[model samples]
Target: MRELGAHAAALAARRPGEVRLRRVGTSRQGAPLLLLSVGHGSRQALVVAGPHANEPVGGATALRLAERALADPRLTEGADATWNLLLCLDPDGSRRNETWLTGPYTLGRYFRHFFRPGFLEQPEWLPEGAAGAVLPETRALLDLQDELRPFLQCSLHGVDVGGAFVELTRDLPGLAQRVAHSAARLGIPRELGPFDTLYWPALGPAVYRVPPPDTGDLAAAITEAAVESTWFHPRPHGTVTAIVEAPMWGVDAVEDPTRPADPDALLRPVGHTLRRDTERLAGILARVRPRLRDTPGAGRLLAPVDDYLLVGPGIADSWDPDAHVPGARALPLLDTARLTALRLAGRRLALRTAGLLHQLVTASGRDPDGVLPELDRLIDAWCADYRVGCGAYWIPVARQVEYQARVVLAAFDLAGRPTRPHPPADRPARHATPRPEPVRRD
Candidate 1:
């Protein structure tokens, strides 16, 4: 964060009047939420990076986008949008994940260093807390949304393992095509299977239509909270929120479109493995809860673990081997099994649990001999399985950053094009009622 802050400061120095850097809000842990405002175009844009703490690929993209906007007028003046970039949204969670941010990027190292916040702790979830209070980070984003009333907002995100895909708040066919072409040119495979946004309506191979704001969907059902970030943004502003994701590790199976000859037989093991892993994780947490419950911030760290333990078994029970996927030409059942195993192996939960315990033991001035090793062993087993099952190959960090930046740039065209405007009803009598701007000359 210090490094990013310094970079932003240096950019402002390079262009004194055009670039403006300001503190929008402070994080729960007291990290400054900095926003870099560049260009003076009439339209407004918000590009958020590191919204998901575990996904650091977007951090690099934010830096690149800022640098690009400073160097090229086309992205800002040409598109007629003053680009406002939030370099990192969840600094507290991002700090915990710094261990694996550097090289020697193996699956084992990645899992060992992984740290994702619980749904409640996340900045993107709505006010699910008592008294309707929100995390400072969430408040920062909401305040910005209200102040800017942007025409475009893009949230940068990435998956641990899979090909590239995108989710859009509104359908923009041109932007989707451009994003897909950029990934293809860079040799990044498009995700062709049911992955994170399985319930989302597909616009193409890698493009998905996100659920409307405040609308009940699979995500809202899971957390019992409306998404407060992209989904909560004012639709009256004609905001097109693009949630873009790239893969850290490229697995060829995720790109496979072959339907299995006997889908049920192929998917049977997935259910069995899910159940087995769920039980294993539950048992691990049960034994460690007594020792770690009182540790500082342990509740915050274990929230996701608790939710996983509660939901994992039920999902396993409901996983039907006989059911057919939406797209008949989706990933083969074997591919589904591989991704599901890696995701449900309790790898993320084990890492977060062990990390918290390590902190507690260290703060007490004692060695970590208690529950850390047990969780470490589970992570090791998960790493071995991932290599064999997923045919794991680490995509270069440069490529992931580039792919995210290209996708956002592609969406510039969508932002530039005028949408049907819906002005607020409470406008003052003296001011002229706003109407959609006529298409501006290049």
Candidate 2:
């Protein structure tokens, strides 16, 4: 976070009037939330990175976009948009995941250092009317959204292992297709099916419409009010919000379009395993609950794991490989494997959360030793699956950044103009880095 801040500061100093760096607010852990604005144009494009602390690609994408905007004024000028970027939205949670940031990018290392806040604690998924619980980082983002009333709000998000995909607040007809095509051109697979946005309305290949705020039973039961984010609110005009996803570790299974002869047989065992593991973890949390009370901030720290235990079983029970949805008679092997990997990833995250909570308990001079051995065993078992098979490989950092940057740029074009946009036949379009002219700050 300090390095990011320093780089932004230096860029601001170098460009003086063109770039503006403002200390927006402080995070829950008291890290400064900085908003960096580049270029002055009629439209406002708000790009939020690190909304989910574990997804680090967005931060790199923000810097890449900044460099592009600084080098080629035409991107901003042509789109008629001022770019407002929050480089790291959740620094407190991000700091927890920093151990693997400079990466060997392996699945074992990634999960070992992973720390994702519960949905309730996330800046983007805070429950409505629970303003009292809003973190400082969320408040800053909310204020910025209201002040800007942006035409385009892109939240940069990613998956643990999968092909690249996207979710939009509303359809900008051809935008998703263009983004997918761009990813394909870059040698990145367009995620075929069964991603996080699987239930949302499909816009095109690898893209889905983000469902209405608080649409499902799970959301209603978990959150006190309708969960909302910059995507739903602050839309004085029609704002096209995009949640762009890439993978930390790309997997071939996510891109495979084949279907097994008995998809259900392939899926049932994994589903049962996930449920059994979730039940076991819940029991462990239940056992350790008494000792956890003495740990300061234990509630905040363990909320994610607790929430998972509360919701995980129900989710697993509802999973059906043969469930019918639009245009599909059976789940493809691609989606079947993707969803399995996705759910297993969630379980691993829950385990990591438990591990962190154990650390806190020990630090507070409380021994939650009864559950420590079990937690270690669970971690080892979960980490083993990801290490072998599952088609997991470390995706180059450059490839992830490039794919996300293209998505952002394409969204900018679609949102800036009223007409339906066409996917470019050429490579991901780039503006020649001409000499930048000094522009007034907004």
Candidate 3:
């Protein structure tokens, strides 16, 4: 963590005018991830950060943006000057994943082992108290937002599977068009709508409540309340809020399956798209920058609600495995099937192979001492098979499998027993019972 801070400080020193670093707060390990502020002080500013642990690109990009902002005089000189940038919100998670960043493993293998989700185990959504109640990182950010009262705030993130870029916003002016144009410029396919098609069935799609659109006192009240309690409740200010998502490693276009498979290939385009969008963002701020300077109170505030409403009764009705595209069904099922198979195989090899050796020794009754050598061989062979067949297959099936394993393991310990079913029911019952034979239509 100190290494990261030193690196950031070095970058800031290289370009002093546009870049400046301040210690926002410490992590669980007491490591500080500095916030890099670019541009001059303005009533309206843009805030962005990355690396939320599992997805490190956001942090990397935030650092890159800080570097570029420092180098470019135009960004900070004129009316378009001054925005607060929060770089690397979760340095703890970032440091946790340092092995993958500096390790010798392939990217696929690294993703499989190092991906860490949010507070609740979801990939992108931050948990209710992630890090702790009023995490220093979150606290510093809210303080800055309140003090600076920036007109726009964006949380940058990336997805591992989907190939499309999405901007999550309740109601922001020209947001959809801006995101779409930026994606097109960067050559990334995009979707501008609800946040529904983001999860798989096994993981369960959770509905998020967005604040109603309004303005003034109510908005300020909601924002203040949120900061005071760290609980999300909708407000009616209609302040411009947006979240940008770039697919980390997947197909280039959601509509086209023939695009490049390498994740690095997508980085340049994603960066370019973000760069273009940032420039447009600059334009938007420039237009409204003077107003904020002239009349700070005139600006509106927007707050995001933090509760996920589980659509329990409507799960089947609203569920669409292929909601994002036509005829593109079964991908999630296929991935889940592969994950379930690998998990079962690994567990079976571990337990069954051990039992087989024990049974052989007991039945022979010719002395259990002689069975030790054969047991070692059996264990080695079983492990080799498990690695090749299960671990290997799990690498490409999205990072969620690893997350699910962690969750299941934790549940097991909490319950004082292995929560995962032993031997995994011999391949998930082969076709899900045929949906009750269609209720005998005749």
lDDT of 3: 0.38
Q: Could you give candidate 1's per-residue lDDT for residues 1-442 as a string of tens digits?
A: 7888898899899898889999999998899999988999888888898888889887788878888887899877887779899988999999888888875888777766667777667787664422254688888887888789888788988877667888777876555456656766666667754445554566665777776545344334453333434454556677888888888876666666565676666456665666677686677567656667456776766776666666555445445454443433343344543444334333433444444434444444533445556656766776666667666677788888988998998886666676534322122113332232232111
TM-score of each: 0.83, 0.84, 0.48
Q: In candidate 3, what are the lDDT values of residues 231-344, reduced to their tens digit?
A: 121112222344445543332223332323443333233233323333432343333333333332222110010101111112211222222434333322222322322233
lDDT of 2 by residue, 1-442 (tens): 8888898898899987879999988987789988889998888989999998888888889988988888887877766778998989998888878888877766556765667777777887645532654677778888888788899999998877667888787777676567656765666656756436544556766776767677445434352223556567755567788888987666656666566676667666665666787777777666777877777767666777776677665445445453333443333334454555555455554556556655555546745455666666666666666545565566678778988998998888777767665444233234332332332111
In TM-score terms, candidate 2 sits at 0.84
CA lDDT scores, all candidates in order: 0.68, 0.70, 0.38
Check candidate 1 and list the clashing pairs: none
Instruction: Judging by TM-score against the true structure, name the best candidate.
Output: 2
Count backbone overlaps in model 3. 5
lDDT of 1: 0.68
